[model samples]
Target: MVNKLVFLILSTVILVGNQSFAQKKITLKEAFKDKFLIGVAVNRSQINQSNQEETKLITSQFNALTAENDMKWMYIHPKEDTFNFEQADKLVELAKANDMFVVGHTLVWHSQLAPWVFKTDKGDTINNAELTSRLKKHISTIVEKYKGKIDAWDVVNEALAEDGSYRKSPFYTIGGESFIENAFRFAHTADPEAELYYNDYNLINAEKRDGAIRIINNLKSKNIKIDGVGIQAHWSLEEPTIEEIETAIKMYSETGVKVMFTELDISVLPSPWNSPTADVSVSFENNPTMNPYPNGLPDSVQTQLAKRYAAIFELFNKHADKIGRVTFWGLHDGLSWKNNFPIRGRTDYTLLFDRAMEPKKAFNAVIDTVND
Candidate 1:
């Protein structure tokens, strides 16, 4: 009798455990429902799985995908004389198989560019004319190659500094400020159907916000096909209130172009470039440890980070009609570029999923925040 009772109790617990587990795990399909879309930036390793396990998981959830590396000049043309498309080819294939839209990361940017493009045989800088020809050729080839495959193109990225001045990007030195116009023109010629966008960071500020408006409006006046503006909301634990971001979005929409929140992530750490001694703890309200957990991101800081992301999505949902898409920079915190830049060699938790592929609170918050 005792043995039977014990066995019965254990069986009951097993069934209850299974039911609880099912409730906690939400698939991408269920999470995404029918509201605003959610997407992730993908690297080669994720798509190259032999069983295509990782690729399927992501594609099933996201209707869109962005190439994290291949579109960059470094990977496309590592050597001046050669062009490589092996990785890019694989990515496009995966997107096709999964019936997902692809976003070509960039046509021109300051970072991750090939050294050979800017330097000559004698080590002197190349002139604007030569650079212009190369820029046109590069844009034409890539845009033409993936003409219909990519849904949209970030023609020029982060072209303005925070203060609203034209950022001193390498493109400026090589093709003059007019490089922006030339890039969009060439991309349009190569693939008129694909949407062209002027992507940048810190547009939340009024100064940068106004400057972006002027540029896009000017392009519209000249009949240059600028389809949208990409606001890279790489916010910190503090700063960039919901109203500020919403205003920026509304400002861009006035130019008759779509607004997208691309490259979204919130880093909870010492701001202003990670001075280890800085008092970042003051930024958070709930959890105020000066030096928190892993990578010095305090638990209190994580709570504040979660709230911040939730607020942004609330704004996104409010403006879903005007907002084109919302994209997270990476699949997991382990793969985020934040771990390296602005504050080199620091472990930063700025992604939705933790290093172990487990969904963080931010992930759930976003799902709950989004309505089907």
Candidate 2:
């Protein structure tokens, strides 16, 4: 009788916790409504409304949504002459329907590009002149299509490497250091009112932070428009001390540009490399040491996750004036890119919601910080 009674109580508690998050009157978007936008990156399933619960979470909790892949160059502009708007249109339509802010991610990227992006229509090597023309056309077309809709554009992304060096992407190789300047110029020409950001990860590293600073300042000096800096906070629990994040935010804000915590997620698994890069391409084979906690997140790890998110949100609240947006890379643990990233088939609990779509302690902790 005691065992059955205890079982009933435990079951009731689980049911209550799961329902409470969605049942609550307020949302993350509503909590931070006046301060800055709360956002999440959306996959196609979410945009298509196939993932109904995720869609509900997005509509309820977030005021902004950036596409996880649709807006990227290859996906939207696959062929040399074929600029596909089907997938991207769905995202914009959903955002508009939900009254959410839209951030058009990635006008240019080193990865995930069709060969036509780097080659001419006639299969010729894209010279500097050809590349510049292509850039102008591509930027103009995309920015114009979603001009009044997408609130911001990641005008350029991950253009710098670690150790403060410019990444030798095809753009840089062909257009020289001047490519970034010209890209921003093209984007501004297409949509003068929409905000433009230079987005990248690992800004907490001093060298990378300073490099981003130099890039933004140089744009401003040249009279090119740069509105914000995106720190893709694809972080771990322990590394990047709060001091470093705060310092980076303060530094970026000093550039007279809004600071954004873009692609924010805290990975609990052991990293394959010690000092990780922002590169999403880096991956390794799964092993027990790296894939610990595959079955489920331990309670201790869950607490640490809560504490970590709370601290970061506290810092964000402290500097709310300088921040423009804070976007999680994904909506929930089951959908997080961290799971397949750096090792496919590795289970990862790197988001505020668990695989069951229930809010973790981290979600409640963030809400408490805002309320406090």
Candidate 3:
């Protein structure tokens, strides 16, 4: 009788162990398979598969990929006549091999642009006609090369000011608002099947959100193929309440285009400025207080991070239909731009994954939102 009992107990333990293993196997991609794609912005190292562990983690957890900087105007077309496809090509091939959706980061932007794009050999500003021609050539060349492979393009990035006016960028100065329209038109002409998006940060603010809508409506009214709006959700622990985010999502979707949470990361550090901003040019001197938690994040702070993520994901789940994709800015905390952005040499725990590539409390929290 005792022997029989032992055999039954052993069988029960084996079955329970298998069930536990299965539960742990559920990944971010698997959890949101029906709702939307789970994507991560990857750098050159990740795309080249140089780090085996990171590559494995990326393939296992995510179903979509965005080249963090490779496909940008400055890197892809550095010189006026020279086009470099070495890294960008590798990224596309990597995405294809993994069967992941590919997002072309950006075609036109005020920042990170090649110098020659707006200047002559004698350091003179180019005319509107020359600028427009250069813009068309740049957009057409990149879009046509990976026409079918790239699923979407962030055609114009950060073109709107905070007060619902056009950012006086060189593009705007040269071509006015027609630059945006021409960009979308050029992209569509190159690849009619690809989706085009206007990406900007701080879009949750009422005025900026309205500005984005104006751009969307303007494109639609002109019959331009603007398909989505990418909100660069570079949020922090205590700013931009859940209601604000949800409202922005609803309002953007009401414009008849999908809303994407692109470049998503929640910083767990103190902001130097009073208001939230993601302007890359802004910087401050780092103090010891600013760089707190350098050794590691405390359990209490980690819990806050986890709960904050949980609430954000719950909101994302509630509006899944309107959200096309949710892409984390980087794969791991160490790779996050938050560590140095706005303040240099400050260690910030912003991403879902920790520095060691292990899923942190925030990652589990995000996954649990769907699992529950």
Question: Order the candidates by TM-score, highest first — what do you get?
Answer: 3, 2, 1
What TM-score number comes out for model 1?
0.84
- Per residue, candidate 1 scores C-alpha lDDT tens digits across 139-235 of 9998999889888999998777666778777678667678888889999999999999998877778888887887798788788899999887777
Worst 10 residues of 3 by lDDT: 16-25
Score residue 294 of candidate 2 by CA lDDT: 80
For all predicted structures, in order, the TM-scores are 0.84, 0.92, 0.94
What is the lDDT of every predicted structure here? 0.76, 0.89, 0.92
Q: Candidate 2: RMSD over Cα atoms?
A: 6.0
Of the candidates shown, which would achieve the greatest TM-score relative to the real structure?
3
Pairwise lDDT winner, candidates 1 and 3: 3
- Candidate 1, which ten residues in sequence have the lowest lDDT sum? 275-284
Clashes of each: 2, 0, 0
Give the best candidate by lDDT.
Answer: 3
lDDT comparing candidate 1 with the true structure: 0.76
- Candidate 3 has an lDDT of 0.92
Q: In model 2, what is the error at residue 2, expressed in angstroms?
A: 41
What candidate 1 gets wrong by more than 4 Å, as runs, is: 1-35, 50-53, 273-291, 295-302
